[model samples]
Target chain A: MAEIIAASHGLVVTQAKDISQSSLALEADVVVIGSGAGGAVAAYELAKAGKSVIVLEAGPYVPSSEFTEDFSQAIVQLYEDKGTQTNADGDLMVLQGRCVGGSTVVNGCVAFRTPDYILDDWQKQYGLTNLTVDALEPYFARVEANLGIHVNPEHEINRNSAVLREGAKKLGISWKPFQRNIRECALTGHCLSGCATDRKQSMLVTYLPWATAHGARIYADTKVTQILAENGKATGVLAEVTDPKTGVKKADVSVKAKLVVLAAGAVQTPLLLQKSKLANSSGQVGKNFACHPSTFVVGQYEEDIHPWRGAMLGIYVDEWAHPSKGGYILEGGGAGAVELSAVTQPGLGEDFMDYMANLKKLAGIVTLIHDHNVGEISWDDDKKKIDYRVAEADYPAMKAAIASAVKLHFASGAKKVYLPTVVHAVVENPAEADAKVAAIELGLQSLRMVSYHPQGTCRMGSDAATSVCTPYGETHDVKNLFITDASLFPTSIIVNPQVTVYTLASYIADYIVQN
Target chain B: MTQNKNKAASDVSAALAPLSRRSVLKTGLWAVAGVSALAAGGFALLRPSPRDSLPVPAGLVHLEAQHYHLFSRLTEILLPTDGTALLPAAQVPVVNHIDGLLDALDPAIRQQLLTGLALFDNAAVVTHFKRFVDLPDADALAYVGDWVNSGVMPKRALGFVVTKLTHTGYWMDSQTWPMVEFDGPVSRRWGIPSRGNQPLPG
Candidate 1:
C-alpha cells in the first residue's frame, strides 16, 4: 500500500493508503467495477466521451515493468485465487485474473470476432435480434484495428503450430492461424503468465491506460462490498480498500455515481450481484453458467518440437467448430515446463522422469467443447460455490474431441500421444486411439479439465423473465446498472471470448452514451 | 483465500461440502476396509497427532515439521535423486516453495490440506501398521500409487494435488530447466523490446 495517489496526463491513480480517514467518499458520473476486458473498454469509451469515471479494481496493480515471465510470480500476482478457482466438484480449474487489468492481463491473447453462427443462434433462440453479425461488425472492426489484431504470419507460426496445421491437412481438416491482439509478439511463450515486454495488448497496456489518459480515475486493491441502491436505481458502491495480499482492510471507500457498470468476469460479477441481492427479478443472476470445458493431449515427437519457443497459442482446427458439425475447437497450445507437467502422462518414479526428459520433443493440442448451460454459481458464507458438471450429453463430444486430438497427433508424426485422464493412458498408434478414448471414464476428476472462458452466468436476452440483463447490457431490474463482461453472454461462444467481450462492451458503451 | 479454500476443499473432499461429520466418520471406516469411501470421510476421522505440535523450520510460514516430512517423502518418489535423474529433488526446495504458497492460502484451506496430509499418512497404519512417513521407500511409492488410481474421488484428488504441487514446485525452479533443455525465460536474455503499441494493420 504505497503511493496512494499519482496524477499524470489528466488521470489519477489511487490506492488504499490514499485515504487517511476511516471512510473516503467520491462522486463520479460513471463508476465501473473490475477493469478487465469489458470494464476497461467501457471506461475508455465513457471517459473519452467526457464522462467523469471512477474505476475500482479488487486486484493489485503490477505493471509491465514488474512482470517476471515466471509462472509462480505471475499466477500469484495476476490470477484470481492464485490460479486455483475451481468448480464445486473440483474437477475443472476455472482461471480468472485478479488485477488492475483483470483477465485480459493473463489471457492467452487469442482474438476472434463473435462467429456468425453464434450470433444467429442468439437471434433465433434467445431473442437477441439486435446482436447480428452486421450490427456488431463495426464494433468488432474498430476493436480489432485499435488493438492491432492480426493473424499470425509465417515467422510467428513455430513448430508447435506447424504440427497442428500439418496434422489438420493430413486428416483433411480445416486449420487456420489465430487472430491475436498483440503488437509484434516476442515469442517468449508466456501469455498464460503475462506478457513481460508489453507486447500483448492486454487491457493493462491498452484500454485501461487509454482510459486513464482520458481522465478516468482508477483505484486498485479495492473490493466492492455492496451496490448501494434505492427505489430500483443504483446510486453508488461501498467498498473496502484492503491490502491485496492479506486482505486487511485499510479504509472504507464509497463512490456515488450516476451510472454503475459491472465487468467483474462471469463468476465474480454474478457473485457480486447476488451478494447485493439486487438485479435478480428474473432469479437468473447466477444461473445458466456455461464454460468451454477444455482438455488437451500432448504429442511426443521424435524431433525436438521446442513448443515453448513461440507464441503461447497459434493455429486452430475449426473443421468441427461449427455447431452443426460439432461445437469444439482444437488449438495448438504451447507452454513452459510447469504447465507441460500438468497435461503430460501422469506417473510416479522413473516412468514420469523419462517422460519429462523428453520435454523438448513434446507438443500439445487442446480441445474446447461447446458445453451446455447446466452449471450454476452460488455462494456459501462468502466462499464462491460453482456447481459445474459437464453435462452427460456433452460427454460424447468431449471424448470425440480428445480422440480427434489423439489422431491429429499421430497424423502429425507423433510417436506417442498422452491423454489427460486419471490413469496414465497413452496411445502408441493412431489405430488404438478410438478404443482407448472410448474407455476413458467421464467421472469427476477422471479427466483433467480447465476453463479460461466462463460465460452465460448472467445472460442477456429479450425476455426479462429468463435473463438478468437486457440486450443493451442493462440489468432488467436495476436502473443505470449495466454489465459488460462475459457474464452477459447468453451462450458459450465456443472460442476465446476476449474479443467478443470487447465488441459487446464497446457496443453497450455506445448504448450507455445514447441513453 | 476464498479461492484457496475452494481448491483445498476440492482436494480434501471433491464432494465434501454436502456430507455430514457422522457420514464422514462412517466413510473413513469404510476406507479402512478397502471399500470405496466418500472423499470427505478421511477428513472427519483425521486425529490431532503429536506431529502437529512438532516444530516448523525457520523461514517457512505455513508448513510444519510433519508437513515437511510428507512432501519430502513425496518428492523422493516423484522426482528422485537417482543417477538417471537430472538433479535430486532435494536440490530444489519444492517443499519450501509449497510452504510459501500455503502462506498465501486461506487458513481453512491450509487446515484442510493438513488434515488431508494427516489422513494420507495415517491411512497406511491399518495395513502396514506403520505411518506413511515411516514406511519403506517401496511401500511409500506403492501406497501413493494406490491413491493415484484409487476409485475414491478424494484419494485420487489428493494424489493429483500432491503430485501437481510437487511437480510444479520442482519444475518451476530454474535448476530443473537443464533437464528439460528449456531456455528458462528469454525476454531479458534476448533483450525483448517493449513495443508499447503498434500501428494498425494496412
Candidate 2:
C-alpha cells in the first residue's frame, strides 16, 4: 500500500521541491499563498481551469494519523501562537488554526450559509450589488456539495448535550439542532482538537486533497513575506522557507506568477499587503474588524452528563437572529476534557465536581453572539502585531445576548445556573436570578466575551475609494491580485465563516477564469 | 540523529552500571539539589503570592465567599436526605477544590474572576442567598440549582467550575453514574460506537 501510494504521487517531496534559491524567476499562471478553505478552493478551481498554480503554506503537512486527541499538543501544533491570549480589554483569548488546512483543521465542523440579512445589509449600505443572496446561492450550493455539508439528524445527542436540550425545554426558549460539514461523526467531541477519525469534512479532508490530486502543489513551512510587484502590477511573491522545528528565520524563496491570491486570513492578509506596501491607496487594508463574542452558561442536573463525549457543537438558537434585535445567534459548543478543564475555574470546578460527585447534576450551553460592528483591527508599527480593540458601542448587544441566555436557562428548568459575567459568578437560585435579570438586562457590558470568528478586516465594496477590494475580491488599487477570506467580509455574517469563505472563493475563482 | 543515538547509548550504559549504594545516594542528592534550584528559580519568576497577585475588586472576595457558602449549602439542599446513604453535598471535595483552583490561576485571570462574582449584589438578593444557605439541605439545593441554571453567575467561571466539579465527582463518586444510567466506563474508553443505540454492557 505504501509503495502504491508513493508510486501514485511520484514522491510527495518532489511535488514540494524547493524553489527558494532559484530567485524570483519562474512565472506561473497563478500563485496562492495559503492552503486553507479559500486558498485551496481557489487553487483547485484555477488548476482545473488549466491555470498553473503554486500554493505556499506556512505550517507542516500533518496527516490524519498525526491528529491526536491530546488537546494541549494539538493547540501547539495547529493553533496560531499556541493559542495565546491577546490581552485586549477583556483578556481576549484568540485561537486561529495555522497549519496547512488553516482554521478548517481545528474549527468546529458547523457549516452555515452566509446569512441573507448580512448580504442584504452589504448590498444596501456598501453599494455591493453583486453580493446579494441570490447571486451567491449557486456558489454556496457548489461549495456545500463539494464539502458534504449536512444536518446530523441521526447523530445521537450525548448525555452532555442532552442536558442543554432539557434546560432549554424547561426554560421555553426555542432551540434547534445545528447543521455541520461532516459525514459519520463518531460523537468523540474532539473536533476542536482535530478529528482523527476522518469524519469531519474540513477543508483539509476535502478541497485541499482535491487540489493536490488535480496537480496544485502546496509547499508547507514556506511563509510568503511580500507580494513582488513591477510597475504597479503584482508579478509574484517573495517568501522564506521557515524552519520546520522553530519556525524562525530560514532561507528565502521567490516565486513568479501572473496572478497572486492572498488568502492568509483576516489578520495575516492585511499584514502581508501592508508589508508589500500594496492596498494602502484607500488606507483600508486592516480596519473595521468584527468578531462574534461568545460566553458559556452551565446548569447542574441530578444526572450523569458528560458533555465532552460528542460533536463539539450540534445545536443553536436562531430565534433572535432576525432583524428584530439587530441580529443575534446562539450556538452550542463542544470541548474535550483538556479544553473543558481549562475553561472551568477553581471554585466552579469544585461545584461541578460536587454535582458530578453525585453523578447526576451538571449540564452546560454556550452563547455565541453576532455582535454589532464595533471593533477595529490595527497593525502595531513597532512590533508588526495585529492589535484588536472592541469598541464600547457593541457592548450592549453582548449584554442583551447574555440576558437572553440566562432567561432561556431559567425557562429550561436548570436546577443551578451560572452566567458568564465578570462581576457575578453564580446565581444561588432561579427566583433571585430572574428578579435581577431585568436590572441586568444588558449583562454583556460587565462580562468578558471570547471571539472565534474574526472578520471584516479588509472589506469589499464597489468603489476603490471606500473599500480595500472589489466585488470579485480583487484589490481596488492592485491589479492581478485578489483576496478570498474572512478579511473581505463586508459584515459579520450570523454564521460560521468557513463555508461562506469557500463559496466566495469559488465564485471569485470562476469570475477570474471567465474574465 | 547520530549524535542523539550516541548520547542515548551512553545514558543507557550509565543507567545499567549504576549499582553502588554510595553513588546512588550521591546521584539522588544531586537530583534533589537540581530540583530545588529549579524550584527556587521558578518561585522567583512567579514573584507574588497567589492571593496578593490576584487583583480582586474592592467588594469581590467577600461576595465570592458568600456565593461559595450559598453554593455549598444549596448543593446540600438539592440532594434529599430521605434516608439514602448518599454523600452530603457540603461534605463533597468540590468546595475545597474550588478554593484551591481559584488560588492557582494566573493573577490576572484570578482578578477578573473576582469581579465576576460581584454582579449579583443587591441587598435583598444577598440576604435571600444568605438565608437560603441556612435552610434545610433540600430547600437550599432547590434554590441554588435553579439559580445556577438561570445563568445568574459569571457564566464562564461558574460553568467551568461546575463542569470540573461534575467530572471530579463522576470519577470520585460511584453512585452518580450508576444512578444516572451512564453507559460508558469511568475512564480510558475509546473508539466510535458501532451504532448510536448500542446498549450498555450488563
Candidate 3:
C-alpha cells in the first residue's frame, strides 16, 4: 500500500514505500492533516464541491471487520497514548482515538449541535459576524442528514440509560433520549472499543467513505510532522509514513497543496503550527483551552441494571446544562470490569472487591461541568504540557452535579450511591452529599477530572490580537491555512461537540469554495 | 521487528499526549467510556510457560515467564477472585493476551512497574520473611497493608503501584467477564438473561 495506487475512482493515492529512503511527495488542491470528524467532513464536502483533496491520517486503519470485542485489544489498537493518557497534573485519565477516523471512530455516536448561546457568544464576543446560530442552522441540518443522526427507539435505550431516565424522572430533572449518528445499531454496547459491526456512522462509515468516492485520497499510517509554509502561506506538509507492523519510520512523505486545512484536532493542529513557527504572531495559537471536567457517580441498584446490555448511552439529564444557572449535566455511562475495578472507589482492597462482586447491580453516571476558564497547552521540554486550570467555580459545580446524581439514584431506588474519587467513600443519603463533596480537596490526587471535547486552543475571532484564526477557521497569520477542528471554537459548549465539529467543517468547506 | 513493539507503543503513545490537558476533556462526561480489563469467566489458568530461559522482553513491560513468577504470585494475592461473581475463573486467563499488552506499553511506565516489583521482592529478606511470592495469601495481604501504611516514600509507592497494576490486570482479562456477569460481544451472549439482581435480598 505504498508509492501510490491509481484507484478505479480516477484518483491517484500515492504514498511512500520508504519515508527515509528518499523524499516522497504528492500534490493536491486541498491537503487535510486529519481524518476525524472535521477533516473527513471538510474533505468530503470539498471533494463533492469538485475540489481535489488529500487526507493524511496519523494512525493505521483497523477495518471494522478486524475490530475486536476484547476492549483491551481495542484500547491499544484504536486509542491514543496507550490508553494511559493522563492530565497535565497526572490526576485524570484522558481517552481519545488515534486511528484513521480519529476519535469519531471510537466515540459513543452522540451528536449535539453547538448550543445557541455559545454561537451567540462567539458572534458577540469573538466578532464572528457570519457564525450566528441562524447562519449555522442550515449547515447543522446538512450535517445531520449526512451523518444519519436520529433518536434511538425505546428498545434501543438499554438498561443503563433506562436507569438514568428513571432516576431523572424521580428527581424531576429534565432528561431526554440522546440523538446518535448510528445506522441500525445492534446494541453491541462496546462503542468505546470501536464499532465492530460497522453500524456506527462515524467518519469511517460516513464522510471519509463519501470523500473517498469523490476522489479524496486517504493515507493512514502517515503522521504530519510539520506544516510546510513559505512566506506566511501554507504550501504543503512534511510527514513521516511508518510501517504499521514494525512501528518503523519508513519514509518522509510530503504533500504540496494549494490550500492546507488542519483538522488534526485541537491538540495536534496547534502543535503542528507551533512546530512550524507559523500562525503564532498573535501568540494565541495554543491558548484558551477549555474542557468540561467530568465527575463520576455510581449507584448499586436493588435490581439488576445489566448496564452493559444497551446502546452504550441513550439518555442525558440537562437540568444543569444552562450556562447561566446550571453548570453541568448528568448522564449514564458503562465501564467494563477493568474500569469498574479501578474506579469503584473506597480504596480499601476488600471494599472495592465487594462492589465488584455485585457488578451487575451497579450503574454509573457522570457529571460534565461546563467549566469557565481559558487554560493553556504548550510544548515544554519536547513533551506536550497541558495547563488545564480547574477553576474554583468548577468545584461547586462538580459538587452540585455529583450530589444531584447521588440523590437521583437514591430516589430511583438505589441502595448505595458513591462518588468515586481519590478520597473514596460512599454517600448514604442526600443530606450528606454536599458536605462530603465540599470537604474533598480539589487536586489531581484528591479527585479525577477528564474531558472529552477539548476546545479553544486555536480560537477563531475577528481580531488578530486575541485569536489564532479568522471566523472562517482560516489562520489569521498563515494564508491558505485553515483549522477546522474544535480548536476554532471560541469557547466551550454544554454538549457533545461532534455535531459542532461537523457543522463547522462543512461551513469551512463552503467558505473555501465561495472564496 | 524485535524493537518494533516498543517503538510502536511509544509512537502511538505520542498521540496520547497530543491533546492539551483541557481540549480533549470536553468530549462530555457521558459521551465516552473508560478503559479497564477484568478476569474472564472460568479461571482456566494459562500459567506462564515453564521455559527455563524465556526471551527477556526488550524492557520490563510484563515480566517474562522465567522472571515473573514472583510478580505472578503476588498478583494472585492482590487480585483474588473469590466472592466476586457467579462465573468461575476462566479456563484460560481473563486477560489472556497480557503478554502482548505488557509488551505494548511505554517503557517509562514499565520501568516504574518493575521498580515497584523489585521493591516488593526485596522487602521480604529485610523483613526476615519468606519472599512475597512464597508467603501465604493471608500473610501477603497483611504485609501489603503494612507496606502501604507504615513504609517510607518509595516503599509506600510500590505497594500502591503494584496493587493497582495487578488489580487492573486481573479485571482487564477477558476471562473476568463472566464473574462480573458481562456477557461480552453480541455474538457471544446478547440474548442471554442477566443474573437476577440476587432477588434483592429481602
Candidate 4:
C-alpha cells in the first residue's frame, strides 16, 4: 500500500491554492489530456517506452481506496454534474465521469470487445480500410488478456441478473453473461460509485498505477483548456487546475510536448479542440455524435429482488441488438438509493414513498438502443455543451426495446412492473403495456432517454472530409495531435465502451511507439 | 476538468444530524456553486444572455423565505410525512432535508429548481386570481398535480425535478433507511472508509 501510494502520488501535479497567480510551464515528450482508459494506457505505454508523458485529468485523484458506498458523495465526486449532464435540448441525460479513472471508475465494468460487425462497418462505411476485424484481433486480444476480461461465472450471477437470464429464457431470447474486467469482485453492487474493492480492474488500479510506476506524470484537477498549436503542428497545451468539487479554476499551467494525445472523451475532446481552434479542417470536430441512449423499466415482485445486492449489471439480452435499423440491448441494472430516487418515475407524495419503500422488491433492466441521429458538441458559455436530439426514425426501435423490457420484467415474476417510459405507471396486466407505451410519444419530454456511453463527434476516418482524426486517431489537420478515446470511433460501438476504448488506446500507443 | 473528488466524496450518508464532514462539504460545494453561478451571471452580463429564454433568476444563491417555505411545504406533500416501520418517516424534518439537498445540488439543477418553482404558474399568472402560496392546501395539491401531469414543458419539467428531489430527500432521511433496508452508514456498508481526508470547514 505504501509503495503504491508513493509511486502514484509522486507523479501527479495537483493545483495548489495560489498556482493560478502565474503560469507553470513544463515539457514532456507526450502530453495526454484526460486520464481515463485512453490516456492511462497511452501514458503507461509511452512511459514504459521511456518517453516523458504528462497526463492531464480534469477531475480529482480518487483511488479505489476512496470508493465508498455513499451514493450521493460518489455522484458528487465521480460524476460530471452529478450524473445529470443533458443534451442541448436538456432531454436525454449523459453519465460521464470526471475523476482520475474517468467513466471507467463509475461504469459497470462491462468489457465488451469491439464487435467484429462494428469494425467492418467502420472499415466499409467510414473509410477505415485498415481497421479490419482480423487486423485488430491482436489489439483486442492484448486488452482482454491484460484486463482479465471474462464472463462472470454462474455462481456470481445475483438475483437481479438471474431474473434477466430467466426472463430471456422464458421468452426464448438469446442472452449471455456480460464479459467484465474484474478479479474477485465482492459484488457489493457499487460499481457506479468507483469500485472500492480494487477488483473491478478500473484504470485507477491498473494501467494508471503502472503508468505512474513507469515514470508518467499525472496532473489531477487540471483542465487543459487549449491544445496549443503553431505552424499547424502540435506544440503543447495551456491548462488550469480547476477545483473538481466546486468547479473553480485554481491554477494556470502549460505543457510543451513533441506529440499530444487528446483522449478527453467525446464531448470534451471536441470542445477542447474547438477552443484551441485546431483540427477542424474537416468541420467535424464536434459533429456526427452517436451513442446508445437507454431507457429503463423496473419491476416489483412479491419476493425480494435485492436489486442493490449483486453485480450492478451481469446478464445481457442482445437478441434485439442488430447492426442497423436501430435495436436495443437489455441488461440487468442496479442503483443505490440516490440514483434510484432521482431517475425513477416521478410520482405524487404518497405514491413516490410507496415505490421507494418497496425498493428491495424491484428489479430494473435498461434498454440501450443504437441511435442513428447525429448530434453536435459545442462550447456554450465556456462549458462543454452537448446538443443531442433523438431522431424520429430511431423511436420505433427505442419503443420496441422498452416494450421488451416491460415484457421481460413481467415474465420474470414481477407482481407490478413500473415502466419509466410510461411515466412510471404500474404495469399489472400484460394487456396494459402496449396501450400505455403507445400512448407516450418518443421524444425528450416523454421518453426521457439517457446514455452512459457516448461515441463519435471527434471521429476517425481515412478521409478528412467527415472526420476530425485519421484512421489511427491522428487529427487530420494537426500533425502529432491525436484523439484516442471513444471520440476516435467514427460510429457508436453500441455496447459498454470501456474495453473498446482500452483496446483502441493500446493500438494508438503501439502506433505512437512504432512511429 | 480535475475536480476535488475528495471534497465531493466527503459525505457518504445523507443524515443531517451531527454536522458531519458530508454536511461541511455540502456547504463548501454550495458556496463554490454560489460563486460560480454569480460568475456565470456576470459572464452572462458581459456577453449576451446565453439563456435569455430561460425563466430563471439571474444569480439566485439561497432561496427566498417565501420560496423556501413553498418548496418545503410542497416537499412535505410530495414526500411521506408519516414515518414507516423501522423508519421514522414522520420524525424527519423533510423540508429541512430538501433545503440541504438543494444546497448540494449542481448549479444547473438548482437553477432549474428555482426557475421551475418560480415560473411554474406562468399560466396562472395570466388568468388565475391566486398565486401558488395564496392557494389553500387542496388547491396547492391540485396545482402540483397539474404541474406533474401537464404536457407543457416548464410545468412538467419542474414537476419532474421536484419529484426526483423530493424522492431523494425522503430516501436520504436517515429514518427512511430501514424501509429501503439499507444500512445508512456508507463506510461500513462498502468496507473502505478512505474518504477520511474530508476537508476542515472552509
Give each candidate's fraction of reference contacts reproduced: 0.34, 0.02, 0.19, 0.21
Positional deviation of residue A318's Cα in model 2 after best superposition, in angstroms: 0.6
Which candidate order results from sorting by lDDT in descending order? 1, 4, 3, 2
> Considering summed lDDT, which 10 consecutive residues are worst modelled in model 4 chain A?
A2-11
DockQ of model 3 vs. true complex: 0.13
* Clash totals, every prediction: 0, 60, 41, 13
lDDT for each residue of candidate 3 in A464-511, tens digit (9 for 90 to 100): 988999989899998999998989988888688899999999999999
TM of each candidate vs. truth: 0.91, 0.71, 0.84, 0.86
- The sequence of per-residue lDDT tens digits that candidate 2 reaches over residues A163-246 is 566656676667778778777777777777676766776666666656655567777777898998777778999887766664
Which ten-residue region of model 3 chain A has the weakest summed lDDT? A3-12
TM-score ranking from best to worst?
1, 4, 3, 2
User: How many residue pairs clash in model 3?
Assistant: 41
Please, what are the lDDT tens digits per residue for candidate 3 over residues B122-166? 455444334565567777777777654432323343444455545
lDDT of 1 at A427: 89
Highest-DockQ candidate: 1
Least accurate 10 contiguous residues by lDDT in model 3 chain B: B28-37
Instruction: Give model 3's TM-score versus the native structure.
Output: 0.84
What is the per-residue lDDT of model 2 for residues B88-151, given as tens digits with 9 covering 90 to 100? Answer: 4444543443343332233444444333232221111332433443445454444434434344
Candidate 3 runs further than 4 Å off: A1-21, B1-61, B64-70, B83-100, B120-160, B187-202
Candidate 2 segments exceeding 4 Å error: A1-26, A85-87, A166-173, A344-361, A381-386, A434-448, B1-202
lDDT of 1 by residue, A298-363 (tens): 999999999888888889999899887888999998877767777754577777887888889999
